[model samples]
Target: MRWSIPRSDAVDVLREQLRKQVRAPFAATAGMVVLLWASLTPSLMPRTALFQALLTALCMLAGYGAGALAGWLVRSCGGRLAGRARVIAWRVLAGVAGIGTLIVLGLSLRWENEVRDLVGVDRVGIWHLVLTVLITAVLLALLLGLSRGIRALGRSIGRFVGRFLPAAASTVIGGLIAAVLIYELAIGVGGNRLLGALDSSFATINQEFRTEIPAPTTPELTASPASSQAWEDLGRQGRVFIASAPTAADIGEFTQEPAQQPVRAYVGAGHEGVDIREEASAAVTELDALGGFDRAVINVVTGTGRGWVNENQAQALEFMWGGDTATVSLQYSYLPSWMSFVLDRQRAQDAGLALFDAVYGRWLEIPEAERPLLVVSGESLGSFGGEAAFSGAQDLATRTDGALFVGPTADNRLWSRFTEEREPGTPQVLPILDDGEIVRFADQPEQWDLPGAWEGTRIGYLQHANDPITWWSPSLALECPDWLEEERGRDVSPNVRWIPGVTMLQLGVDQFSANSVPQGQGHQFGTAPVYAWAEILPPPGWSDERTDELAVVIGDRAWLR
Candidate 1:
């Protein structure tokens, strides 16, 4: 101790700081190894030497500062107080190091708002964060426990070693133990963090594939003609994005006919539905809130590009495109459901009568007073079921009351022709999310056209202007000059439909993205307003005067809550 000299010279300062840096990291590493071995570290550490250095340095700084203070306080306290103070000090220091480990884990995971205030906007990859947290926790817990053990064992070691040898030998033994701890710490770090960090950070991250999606590959969004003009590539409305493919064909089983009686309809047996058969992608997503119905059926789903009926709680019907690990893009929802193919009109008639008899037994044969209200609704396939349900309800001697048809190219035309007229109900659309906040989108009429199929019928349209998914193409909206500036019936609300809710949910929110190219705006990115049914626009970004028929944010702050 007398031989050692303390100096404040620049050279000395650098030397001391360097030594602390070097030794502290080794100390920290040794602590971590022991902690990890003890199953007490908080998170998994990066397998790089640089990451190890950073971790070791932090732990060392915290541990040493606490240890020095404790040593000082103990010297002053002189006895039992010193021993207790030492324990308390180590506990506090180790606890802090453990917390630091958690913070590191948050960084690794990259979810900025996980703690909201602590981290912002960095969505850490889920697995990495989890792994890091687990490892760090194990490390920290082990360190704390080891510190306690060290305190307990140090005195015992001193007494036993001192009795066996000369006092000098005891000093040698203590030094050897300290050296072994220090050596273990020095060897544990894996070191790539420090190396790669020397190069450009962005380069490293890009090369790592740890940030951002790779460049574009979709033909619909490449150097082709489609990329030349401004076109919505994929449109995501809520959880659904119905991007009209170049290969779009009449996937609907029914054919379209002109509207009659203000709301024309078509009727087909078993699978005759599509009234306004236009093609884009159509789908339905039953999310958290929409899980209200146990037996749920979504008509004209934008994602599946087909009608879905969930009879029992099982997967919906789908077009078969075989593969393992289906890309959500190509086959969004490929469900399995029962379907009967009627090869000819005669088959439909035969099945219709026989099916009617069976359905009649359950629907009509049951006491009319005992039956519950039936909900009949559909676009294409949905319309077929609606018709059968309506007919079945009639067979049961209970008149089918409320019926709504969407994209009714067939059913609406026929249903309107059959129904006897009564006083037309004034359209009752509700905007519950706001007081008087109105969202105006171009291609969407002033009053916003409700599906024409609603005329002379109790129809409810869950629409946001021209939903391209149900065939109201952006091309149609664009062609209809002053589609926005026109009166309600002439352009927007066409006399028979209503909106029960204003705010609509994003189908697959943050998940909405398109394969992008290097060229600016070449992204036929699946933007909601730009392509899909629910042209969802974010809060107050698009103004009143601007009308692109794009989704505009219309609700109040409370809607978020």
Candidate 2:
């Protein structure tokens, strides 16, 4: 028979539990401190005044929010259990890190196209991601638990005391002040009312990013979109679309020997996609020099004084992805002189449009209306030029009676926006996979990852396995944005084995570094990540067991094996 304990005794037992919970984190605290110290790589330069001020302001506002979360946690979980929570958190973080390491290893080890296709490997394998999450949770939990223990021990909270608060409150207050200042004093600068005064802030914030390019010999640098198209149109029949992207040396980095190139890629071992940063107008000049294609889809190769460059090339190809294997590209021949962080992007988009248009016009001249339509598609930007080119093809397909859309970010807005501009329900927009399978960041902020009617259309999301730009967003990751359960064809979530190439999105960015600076330090994140072709694709039709010898052999370095 057990004797009943007094209320004081019960309280003491509860206290002991809390005390133990609190101690676990404390025990790990020294390890965490050592780990953090080892991982510490401070910024080379001093924090800017604005960054400092903002940080301070953020710290102030966060105080309240942190207090609230802390109170809530303590109340809900019983403060004594905090140590256990922290331990669990650390364990989770360790798990995630382990997973990430494994993913990296798997991707480098057992890689192939069919594996990429059927098993669904991406840049970071799912296991790797699991590890990363575990690591993050574990690290954070360890910190939290240690803090709780320290506080219970009557120690000072230190700088981190501010982190738990509501960060947005201070930001809102600061933004209001800044907005008021701009409106009153900076009116003329903001005159374009179209691109509000706030636009410059984004530019200024992004200006610190750096990209190293070899100095051009010609001071009079030019980027003619039409001209660029003419120069590159020569590669359509069998010219692999080697990455036109230039490295710091300002030279096309095609794989050395062609046949030994990677599968599903243009250039050789150095990586397939190009990173040319010429002027927006360069393609026009190149096209003019080359004498252009005749009949095209959206933009005529030789426009009878007809239209601007178009998006037909990509549209036509995507129109027939599995119909007949074809490679497409948007590149610049001569690096442009008028290059900036921003203009590099615009020119690439324009040049690509011109090339596609030229390609389309060539198709038109075939005069064989009986040609079984090859699938056509292209990735567009979140801006005007890409929208125009994409919309042009979309419109034409509707008129012609056949077209399809693929890629991570399909144009769902094309329906509502295009309809509003023209007649209601005038243009036909058929998203083979409803707006749900895989949504892009540029498409719609609200509908990301939401479920839609599942249709088992044979769809392929060519997500370059480890293209950093396409993955690991601080904002989107929290949402569980893509579908977890497969509704249609095989689950196409890329992993270590399966890899997506970065040719398309890389074209849209100006400088590779320009796209990567927000999250990472320098601009290294902007460049496209590579994978092996033989490694990424499903067993191509050409091969029996191994990847098609000729294709994978030739395209060897084109992708990462």
Candidate 3:
């Protein structure tokens, strides 16, 4: 009779156990907090106070929301798994079936476009997708495990500190410590090394591609003793591999060619034996010797880390000015631009600022009425470095008559500022400030219709929708970027969905694949520059027919090839 009077103890015990499941939510939220703190911010140095606060608040809310959803899912499903043996068996079979289904679906999915978008080849196999999925899954699982470990470690420390200090103080200290450790382990060691290896490997291949392209030469550059000595100094002392300029004969034959041949002064200081400042000085001397100041447009160019002066840009300027422009640039580093972006942005800034300053100082010495139009131009890392010369947009406006930066990196302070303070409702990718008064951005040729023909000193930033260099940032994890929310870039996959951790990883992969396709087709502005510059620095009485012709010639040259 007493045994039949069951004590409701079992029910009480089950309730207590269910209540203890609160830790899952806490753990998940803590893990998310650690991840957000460790990785989601773009840079430790916030560009502005408001932006920093906004990022923090957004991440915190996202982390908490994700944690709550995860907790709800776990709790809702926890009781369904009853007997341990049955639960284990179900898990095993479900895993097998899940994998088999994934394999079948992945093989069936049309991945040709995805592969082509990534590496410019449509020759992808089902095995490739399987392998990619496998690798990505492993990495993501590892990240989750690491985040969990961090949260556990932080909680344990917080409990320990709470014994000797206030609970709030203990929590704060524990969080700060966990954040530091996670950052060091996740970003400083693992991510940096991974990015470096990818960059270095690609650079080796890139260098081979560059070395194969024979450097152009002309007799006119080597005609006089002084010119030959300057050319020799550029080649020997300057450690330059290529120094080319159009001869009188080449310029005379312009009627047959779509673009007029112009003087191009380049000091190849890319290798280890070169001195940056010395080579810059040599480049200025060579340009002066070539009578560059007498040209209608004098362009101070910035090279990528590997010393590529973006021939597309140079060709555009030459065609615009009817081959009357003088372009001068010097090599700063031999590493690929992505490498320098990750490793040595300062060197680019130094080279760009120094070269422009030297050239500008010399240009200032000439009579204002007689001096050639002083213009500054750079692409990719060149743009990042070139913008370093100006303190702000106003500084750029005052210092130079015209500036054109193509595919400027996201971290470029000037680009960031202008984009932020741009006209309300203007797309970030193509902002038109003050009706294109002083600054304008263009994604393609047609979008360059500046109202009233912007008659004063102006700057144009040309960035494609698909260029990772223009869009990638740490904040992408928690907040949707403007580019992704609107029209996806031409090269980007339309099905590219944004998941929390998954999207961040995908973009990282995208950054590497950005240059895989031919230039102008992807990150390279092959023919776009011709169209972009035509709008930015349109020649007096320039016609659409001429612009189309310039594009055709620039595409035909394909100088990088």
Best by lDDT: 3
**Residue 501 alpha-carbon offset, candidate 1, angstroms:** 34
Q: What is the C-alpha lDDT of each candidate?
A: 0.27, 0.29, 0.64
Number of the predicted model whose TM-score against the real structure is largest: 3
Give each prediction's root-mean-square deviation over alpha carbons.
Answer: 27.7, 17.5, 10.7
lDDT-better candidate, 1 vs 2 = 2
Tens-place lDDT per residue, model 2, 453-479, is 422221122222122232322333233
Flag clash pairs in model 3.
Answer: 240-268, 520-524, 520-526
lDDT of each residue in 1-561, candidate 1, tens digit only = 366445657678899877753443223443443332222121111122223333433353345445444544555566333477756756665776677656554443332223222211232345644554455455545555555455345445656788988865675475467546644554333123322232233222212221233222333222123222112222111111112111112112111222111000111111122222111111011111122111112122211122222111011111010000001111111111111111111222232223223323434444656543332333322333334433332332243323333322122223332321212332212121111121111222233332322221132222222221222222331243122233332112232121111001110110111111111111111122222122221112433333332222111101100
Task: Give model 2's TM-score versus the native structure.
Answer: 0.32
Off by over 4 Å in 3: 1-125, 133-251, 256-261, 270-278, 487-494, 518-520, 558-561
Q: Which ten residues in a row have the lowest lDDT in candidate 3?
A: 41-50
Query: lDDT value for candidate 1?
Result: 0.27
TM-score of each: 0.21, 0.32, 0.69
RMSD of 1: 27.7
